[model samples]
Target: MKQDVQPLIVNVKRYTLVRNLVFGWLTVVLFAGFLLNFPKINILEHTARNLYFHVPMWFTMMAAAFVSGYHSLKVLQTGDPLRDIRALQAARIGTFFGILGLSTGIVWSRFTWYVGTDVWWNFDPRQIMVSIQLLIYGGYFVLRSAFDEPNRRAKISAVFNLFAMTALPFLLYVIPRQMESLHPGAEGNPAFSQITHPVMRLVFYPAIIGFIGLFWVLYTQRVRVAWLKYRVTQDSEM
Candidate 1:
């Protein structure tokens, strides 16, 4: 007799209330901090409100990319095709959040630049490289779907994902510092200003945590859905 394997369940029911309580408390603290301290920033003033959404978007993007790279590494080591699918979903979702982050940052820029002071888009190397990073993953999805052979798709994507992960550090940190820009922390900029404010920290930290948690939830769901579909297709073929 053949043994039946159970599908994975991606839930933590025992800690449901605890997680909710923590998330609620953090959300309240972030909102309160933002309400109280937002006026102090001269650059954006009221427009600084974008920080709540903008920063969180970036955090989620990083989380997604990290998850993608992790699964890619696992697939390479273990030769598990499911891990490759999970990694692809992470890249797809992460890119969505990255684009959202870029859009929100641009809106904030427009408010600060005060119209006509600069172009709508700049040729900054960081921006250009990050955009290319986005396209690289976009092509990844297309390439994966183009092949009917699971083994070939997984191997090719794993190699490409490893290469793409290297660009992340450059795009997120290094290249930004090399150029002049309207964005903060540019051109050898060093300031404790953003990180040191207690009120801002209250909001920023939770926002980061909340966004990361949210990404995990979404990624888990995507994997479950894809796994189910894969099982169904296999059954029908049999």
Candidate 2:
């Protein structure tokens, strides 16, 4: 009994520590993101400030994909229900970040690039690819719900999750760059490093770390809640 309780206590303590640390770290990133001075450029003027926020959303999504993929792989090997919970939570958070990224990109583009045209989405290659990527993950959730059995759902969804993860890099980064895009890093367009200022990098790097930390905190919190529900109801679907 003591041995079992000891692991729970340790997990509680570690979760508390990470929770507090991420909260404080993100607070700093928020302030630094706004306070840091950046060089001004035409059309992108103040919107350039979004570099600290908008870009990190995709980065966090990528991190979440990798985490979800790892857990899916474990579920295949160990057939652990807990691993399914982790994978589901991670994918959910990743989708959330992707939505945020798309929304922010729309807002940024409307204000800066499409000011007169009233166009919210220009069907940019990167934009289209990211939308497709989100749809793929959406299918993962749908696939999970198609099954009534816990073990069966976990097994099938884990396979689909792996395929989704495999397509993420290609959709989000590779194919986007090969096509014509308003976004940076497209064919003939300057990469981020070429256009970003040194001062912005200071905040940009920390912002990525902070947002990924935020993802972890949220993901872990969901896992704990799902695990508790599983224990009480004997239903892993929660």
* Each model's Cα RMSD: 4.1, 1.7
| Per-model TM-score on C-alpha atoms | 0.84, 0.96
For model 2, the stretches where C-alpha displacement exceeds 4 angstroms are 1-10
The TM-score that candidate 1 achieves is: 0.84
What TM-score would candidate 2 get against the native?
0.96
lDDT per residue for candidate 1 within 19-134, as digits (tens), equals 57656865775666457563366656666656667878877887788888888889899878688878887887899888988777776776576466766666665567668778
- Candidate 2 residue-wise lDDT at 78: 95
- Candidate 2 local Cα displacement, residue 35, angstroms: 1.1
Best by TM-score: 2
